[model samples]
Target: MSKISFEGIGEVAATFACEAEVQAGQVVGLTGDGTVGPCESGGRICGVALSSEDGYAAVQIGGLCRVAKTGEEVTPGFAKLSADGTGGMKKDEAGGTEYLVLRVESDGMVIRL
Candidate 1:
């Protein structure tokens, strides 16, 4: 089989902030101080950043998204935050907080919350 990617599958939510640019494909989490960065366990996994930008970054909140996998293989089940504490998604067994895993793809898993 070949790789697959899908965009614009859900409602897009974004806001303007003073934080630095957010890169695409990176898991973004809203910080306690009202900023965005790589998600961490327990931190809110908002969605994947659309692209790198200084302000007004677009975030994909719901639906299917092609994200970068943190560790080993993943299955269709609960999605776990990255073990490295970088807010990335990993297989539930990777040692991190768990979230509902919608669908497990070869490159990443689709999360909805």
Candidate 2:
């Protein structure tokens, strides 16, 4: 059997139409209409919005990005994170996606997607 493994090269970002108003630095998810919008609690995260302009947003899909927290203290290290339902991230103990948390600051935490 042939084996193959895929790894992301580097930071990846893409532009997408917004389903609704999205601010920069907010975590977004794919909407039913194929547009991007603020991710709801426990929703599958698509990427972090780097900029929002003209009904569109530039989202970072890979590599390190800063994300707002849901006021829950999370120790810096490896942990699972999920949407906070209001454009922020939270420590998900209930089988969420895992990411490497590089640092925890008062504003937000740096995570490698």
Top candidate (TM-score): 2
* Best model number under lDDT: 2
User: What is the per-residue lDDT of model 2 for residues 10-113, given as tens digits with 9 covering 90 to 100?
Assistant: 67999899866789989999885657998889877999988898888888899877788875688878988899988888998885798888777786777888
lDDT of 1 by residue, 1-113 (tens): 43654444665666534246466767777764546776664344666777657655577766766665666677766656552345356654535566666566666666653
TM-score of each candidate? 0.64, 0.84
Angstrom error at residue 70, model 1: 2.0
Candidate 1 runs further than 4 Å off: 2-7, 32-34, 41-43, 81-87, 93-106
Cα lDDT, all candidates? 0.60, 0.82
Ten residues in a row with the worst lDDT in model 1?
79-88
lDDT, residue 40, model 2? 82
**CA lDDT of 96 in candidate 2?**
74
